[model samples]
Target: MREQPPYLRVADALQQRITSGEWSPGDRLPSRAQLAHEFDVGDNVVRRAQELLITQGALEGRTGSGTYVAEVRPRLTMVRARSREERGGSPFKGDMASLGKHGSWDSRTEAKVPAPADIAARLGIAEGDLCVCTRYEFLADGKPVQLTTSWEPYDLTAGTIVVLPEGGPLAGAGVVDRMASIGITVSRAIEAPEPCHVTDEEAALLGVARGALATTIRRTYFSDDGRAVETADIVIPVALGEIVYEVPINL
Candidate 1:
């Protein structure tokens, strides 16, 4: 068997210390130089180990201070159920409310963006077709929770009252209702969730270490005519929450 990498080995050792209660939550760690000397490893190796721990929520780094054990917080529970969407409004905010946490999201929309090959295929539009892209940062109780990038073909909603997802009179209304307003009935939605590593931008926004484990969901809403009306990629950090899909079985 291949030996564990130096950094990983150090990370495991540090994790063991935390789990064994040698280091309690909120206890600041020794300086990187001290840890390097103690572990007989280079400073870079210790730094990498510390970063790995930070990403796992075992430790947190304070700006200009030092690394400390992270205070435990209840993991968020995110649910994906058909019933939630049927109820209308923002399912995310409702879900958070159900858990007694406030939910809010910040969104920025870019219009007339040329679709990339991948997005074009998903939306069944020609490559370079104009699209409206909206990026969202979702927060729970003012803490970053997830990131989403949504895309809609420009021609689909152009010259309509709901052109901008978060604008117009129907602002903040969900996709199902928004499409219904334009006489398009959204029949179904398909989602593909996959495990991934957090990118630098995602890490910065989610307040986790780079390369942290995460889940990315590629979701698309389809109309009754089998046309894809909207697609979004949502990224959720593993350390922050767990995702649950609730399916209702007809008895």
Candidate 2:
């Protein structure tokens, strides 16, 4: 029987030690030479072992500092693609509530922003159409967990109290509710989830390392009459929280 590689054996041993609480999260690992001596392996073997653990996300190397155990953080749950007829409450807040954590968010809205071509297409509008765009940073226990940028045709909301999303009486009321307040019924929405990588700015906001795994959920809402009323892109960290959807199963 051939034996496993020495480095893999060392990594497995270290994994067990870490999981067994012999070393806690954020605890610096021993020097490569020290580990090699303890494991009765060469320096190269210990380096290979450490590199493997870093790639597996079980360990991290800090510049000018030694490698340490990675700290695991809780991920926020994302519930997308709900039927618009359903109440348009904040799903992020609901997720936080379910986890016994307080949820809040900050938003900035800009009016008369010309829609970019891609966004305009999603909203079924012409390119450069005037629109109201709002960016939201969702937080759980005051920590930013997700980000969203939503675009709505200004024509659908012009002269309405809800024209400025997050600025009117219905501020932060959510897409369906805001549209409903103006006699528009958003009946359904389409959401597509795509795998993504974290941007530097998103990484800073989400408090995750740059290049971390992420997921982008793109959603578009349509009025009962088939008019596209709103669209948004939501970004979530893959490592932090889970993205859960409540889809009905057909028997």
Candidate 3:
């Protein structure tokens, strides 16, 4: 059998500890030199091991604060819409059923102004449009899992069912679902995924440190007749959650 790379072996050892909860979230990990000595390997090997964990969202390094275990949570799956011909016998179903009950929307207010230029363009709206943004911080297994923000056309969403008791639509049911009830079916959903640094405001709401690694998914929903309806920006802390996508292979 081929020998396993030293760095990978070291990373596996650390990962085992993390998966076993031996090192909890926010717990500092050993320095490179210490890890090197512990594994009887070179410091470079330990550094490589740390890098692996960082990319895997299992660890994070803070400038001057040292490396630490990242909070871990179940990965969230993003399923692309299937074409009509590819739908087969059963149509594609959203996985909201596994996301637990539609919890009460906890109101989180941010005084920040209009949507950024890029976001406004995605929503096909004028720049500097006065918007009321409602945000909800979701939790799973008593840990922060996902942070969601919804931006609506200030005039249209104001004093409507959209701004009901929980503020915004119910959980498990996205903006598209709520809009469809009023004869608006989301025909197109444009999504962009990119790596981002957590801002102070986002960190506070997501319970993560500023500058922490995160995945930002920006989604714009369009009506069946091709009208931009709503736009949402969701940020998932790398450690706390992962975006998973699976594609089947052909025979």
Candidate 4:
């Protein structure tokens, strides 16, 4: 195997400390110059390491301020199509409770008009077909973390448990889990990841500066027979949250 890069080694060192509980959440880390000197590497190398940690949800950096450890832990439990696993049981779990109590929701609202061509294509519906759309902004510790819009066919979603008037059922339970309860298991999830800039409208909703770096994850859920049922577009602040996957090599 190839040797790991210097920056990656640096990231691994920091990751070990975070995982070991040596560096608790909300803790400040060393400055770039300080870390560079400690690791005997250039500042660029240290910066790269920091970037990796941020992407992994291990660290977060304020624009003018210094870097800090993120309070949110990584998810450990395995999630299947039809199971409700408790996230509190794991050390680095992604519990819905982690979203924070003070984190507010502006109340989910339905889409007034037809979805755009792109969204319609993903939902497997016509461009002008009416679709049920709900927009939500998720926050952590009073800071906007994610902006998402979930879409489904109007006929299938209208007045259903999936579209509750207030505090929608899709709030904390997640769409996948809730669907499983209704006998609609998401056997497969297809995600497309791409870099995106915070639009003016999105920035206002997410309470972030315009042009901030973000990751757009368009996820499509399918049943065991490969029938697509729902589509969700999630925009996450690159500096705050991370998308993690735990893949087992031996299936």
Candidate 5:
């Protein structure tokens, strides 16, 4: 077998130090030059190893300060279920409440935005069709945990109180209930989850490194009459949370 890369070896050694309690959370690591001398490798190798550990959430770099062992945070458990809508509130809020964390989100909505081809396809609309687009950053205890971009055909809710998803009397009522208010019942939603790397924009919002491993869920809600009403792309950083699918089995 090929020998492990020098950087990987160094990273393993550094990680062992943390796991063995030699270095505790918030404890600053040795300088790269010092580590390189101790490991008998180039400083570049030590830098790479530290970068790897930073991406893995084992270490963190502070501006003007040295690298340190990162404080371990419990991963948030996000439960996905068809019944979440029936529970009559934001599913994300419920998930956070289960863990005793405060759930909140910041959103920006743009009206009459032209849908791109891919988003159009997901909403079963033609490219260039007007849509209401909203970007959301979900937070747990004021820290971003998830991101979502939602699109819906402008005509579907035009001139209706539900047109602005985050505005009006039904503000934050959620898609399912909001649609129902407009005489359109959302029958089901289909979600396709896939592994993805964080984009620059996602990285900024999620406070993670670009190219970090994440999960993307492509979700489309459909009406009982078989019409696609809304579609959203949900992004969750793997280091911060986990996705759990709960399917009810009827007896």
Candidate 6:
């Protein structure tokens, strides 16, 4: 039989300690050098072992602090009302309603931005296409909860009243309603969620430690003709909340 590699062997040993209750949740483990000596491996090997545990959700790393046994994931929730049938208003408002909390948002709009490759694909626009970019910081009960940057094709809204997103009369209205006002009826929205680590900028705004886990959502709003009208990247810290999707069963 083939033998396991050094890092895996070291990680296994640490896992044993955690499962045996010797290292309790929220308890910091030995320093990398100490673990290297304990396992008779190099410091790099111990570092890899800790990374493995972190990826498994068995451990967590704080940028300036040491790694610790993972605690129960936070219970914060942001509800996703995927369908119009499930939605009452904007996603922020919907989330507040689900949690029985008050919600507010601050937005800044930037115009004449050229759509990058990924965004162009989602918005079905050409590369370097002019667009309006708006960044939103949402707060629930005076605490920052979610950050999103929305992009709208300039060619689609160049001379329209809602082109600036949060500047028109219907400013702050959602993509669904905003598009509806502009002769385009948004038929549906799709969201794809993935796990990621907090970046320095996000960590500062979301008030979480850098390297902390977070949920990144890529959302697209579609029109009646099935063309994408708007696209956004929404990031929510794992420490602040979780997301619940209201998916229905169709036969």
- How should the candidates be ordered by TM-score, best one leading? 1, 5, 2, 6, 4, 3
Root-mean-square deviation per candidate: 5.3, 7.8, 10.2, 11.5, 5.6, 7.6
Model 4 bad stretches (over 4 Å): 1-104, 111-113, 165-172
Per-residue lDDT over 20-52 for candidate 3, one digit per residue giving the tens place of the 0 to 100 score: 989999899978888889999999999888877
RMSD versus native structure for model 1: 5.3
Candidate 6 residue-pair clash tally:
0
Scored by CA lDDT, what does every candidate get? 0.89, 0.82, 0.66, 0.67, 0.89, 0.82
Cα deviation of 101, candidate 1, in Å? 1.1
Instruction: Report the candidate with higher TM-score, 5 versus 6.
Output: 5
Q: How far is candidate 5 from the true structure (C-alpha RMSD, Å)?
A: 5.6
Please, what are the lDDT tens digits per residue for candidate 6 over residues 1-251? 89999999999999999999999987998899899998889999998898788767687665456778876644567667655333634657766766878788888999999999999999998989998999998888756778899999888888889898888787777887777787998878889999999776776565556577889999998888999889999998877887888777889
**How much RMSD separates candidate 6 from the native structure?**
7.6
Model 1 lDDT tens row, 14-47:
9999999999987999999999999899999999
- Reference-based lDDT, residue 93, model 5: 83
Q: TM-scores of all models?
A: 0.75, 0.70, 0.56, 0.56, 0.75, 0.68
Model 5 agreement with the true structure over 1-251: per-residue lDDT tens digits: 99999999999999999999999997999899999999999999998998788777788665447788877667887889877778776778877887899999999999999999999999989999999999999999977789999999999999999999999999888999899998999999999999999885776567566578999999999999999999999999898889999999999
lDDT, residue 111, candidate 4: 49
lDDT of 2 by residue, 135-185 (tens): 988888866778899999998889999998878688767777888888998
For model 3, the stretches where C-alpha displacement exceeds 4 angstroms are 1-105, 109-116, 163-165, 168-172, 246-251
lDDT by residue for model 4 (34-146), tens: 99999999999998898777655577666457778876533222222212333212111243344333444444767445878987888777887777677777654455667
Task: Tell me how far the alpha carbon of residue 160 in candidate 4 is from the true structure, in angstroms, after superposition.
Answer: 2.9
TM-score quality measure for candidate 1: 0.75
In model 2, state the lDDT of residue 131: 94
